[model samples]
Target: MNEHVPDPAAKLEERAKRKAAKREVKKTEIAASTLDALKQLGYANTTLRDIAAQSGMSLGSLTYYFTDKVELITYCVRLYKAEFIDRIEKSVTSAEGRDAVIDAFADELTRSMTEDLPTHRLWYDIRSQAMFDPAFRPVVEEIEGKLLETLTRVVQAAGQQDTSAVPLGYAMIDGVFRFLLQSRDRHARDNDELMAIFTAILRRIF
Candidate 1:
C-alpha cells in the first residue's frame, strides 16, 4: 500500500489558517499592551514605541499591523467595545424584571470598574480625543451607539415609559464612570458605592 500525501491546496489552506490564527493572537496582545500603556502613560504620552515595548514586538512588526498610533488606538477601542458588549449581553440576559435589569447593569459596571479600571480609563481617554479628532469619531460614535442600544434595552426592560430616558440613563452612568476615572480619592470608588449610585440613577430614570 502506498502512503497518502497531503494535497498542495490543503497544505496551503492549513498554513493560511495557522497564519491567520497567529495574527489574531498578536492583535489581541497588541490591544492589551495598548490599553496598559494608555493606563500608565496616558493617551497623549503613549507612543507606538511604548506599545511595541509593552507588546514585546519590534516597532517594525507593530507598524506592519497597525500602521500608526491612530489606527492602533482605533483597533483597541473596537476590541474593548466588543468585550464590553459581550459582558453586557451576559449581564442582562437572565434579568427577570426592571429591578433585576438595574441590578445587572450595576453589577456589570461595578465589575468593570473594579476589575479593569485601566481599560475604562483608556476608553475615556480615547473618547475625549474623539471629540476633536475626525479620524476617531466614527468608531467612537459606533461604540457609543451600541452602548446606548444596550442601555435602552435595560431601561425598557426595567419598565421605563419614556423613550428619552434611555439616553438620560446612559448619561447618568457615563457621568459617574467618568467621575470615578478622575476621582482623587481612589478608595471611595468602591463597587458598593458604584452599585448604589447606579441603582438610584436607574430607578430615577425608569
Candidate 2:
C-alpha cells in the first residue's frame, strides 16, 4: 500500500509560513543591529551599510527587509518601546509596597544611567530628532504616553493618592538625568546618594 501524500496546497501554505517566519527573524536581527549601530555611531552618522555589516546581512538583503533607514529606525523604536513597557510592568508587579516601588524606580534609573546608557542615549537622540522630524513624532508621542501611563500605574500601586505625581516624578527624574549628562563636575555619585535623591523626589511627589 502507498503512504498518503501531503496535499500540494497545504505544502505551499507551510512554505509560505516558513518564509514569513524567516523574514520576521531577519527583520528583528536587522533592527537589533541598527540599534547597536545607532548607539555607537549616533543617528546622523549611522548608515545602512553599518547596520547590514553588524547584522551580517548584505546591503541588498537588508534593503529587501527594510526599504530604508527611516523605516528600519521606526521599526526599531517600536520594538524598543514594546520591550521597555513590558519590563516596567514586570518590575513594578513583582515588587510589593511603596518602599519596594521606590526601590524598583531607583533600580531602573540606575540601570538606565549606567548599564543601559547606550539605549537611553539612543532614546534621547531620537527624542531630540523627533522635535524636527515628522517621521519620528508619532512613535515618540506614543512611547511617551505609554511610559507616562506605566509610571502612573506604578505610583498608584505604591499608595500614592495624588494623580499628578507621575508627571512631577518624571520631571524630577528628567532633571536629574539632564544634570548628570550636562554637568562636568557631576561625577562619582554613589548609589546611596542617588537613591536618597530619588526617595526624596518620591516623597515630594506622593
Best by TM-score: 1
lDDT of each: 0.84, 0.79
Which candidate's lDDT is highest? Answer: 1
For model 1, the run of ten residues with the poorest summed lDDT: 181-190
Off by over 4 Å in 1: 1-18, 159-164, 184-187
Task: Please write out the lDDT profile of model 1 over residues 1-206, one tens digit for every residue.
Answer: 98999799999999999999999888888898888888899899999999999989899999988889999999998998889878977898899888898789788878887787778877888888988998999999999999998877776677675778677768877887788767825556667887887778777777
Error of 1 at 193 (Å): 2.0
lDDT of 2 by residue, 1-206 (tens): 99999999999999999999999987888788888889889988988999999888899988999999888988998888788778767777888889888788766665556655667677788889998999889988888888888888888878877877677777776777666654524676666776676677766665
For model 2, name the residue pairs that clash.
Answer: none
Residue 15 in model 1: lDDT: 99
User: Which regions of candidate 2 fall more than 4 Å away from where they truly are?
Assistant: 1-18, 182-186
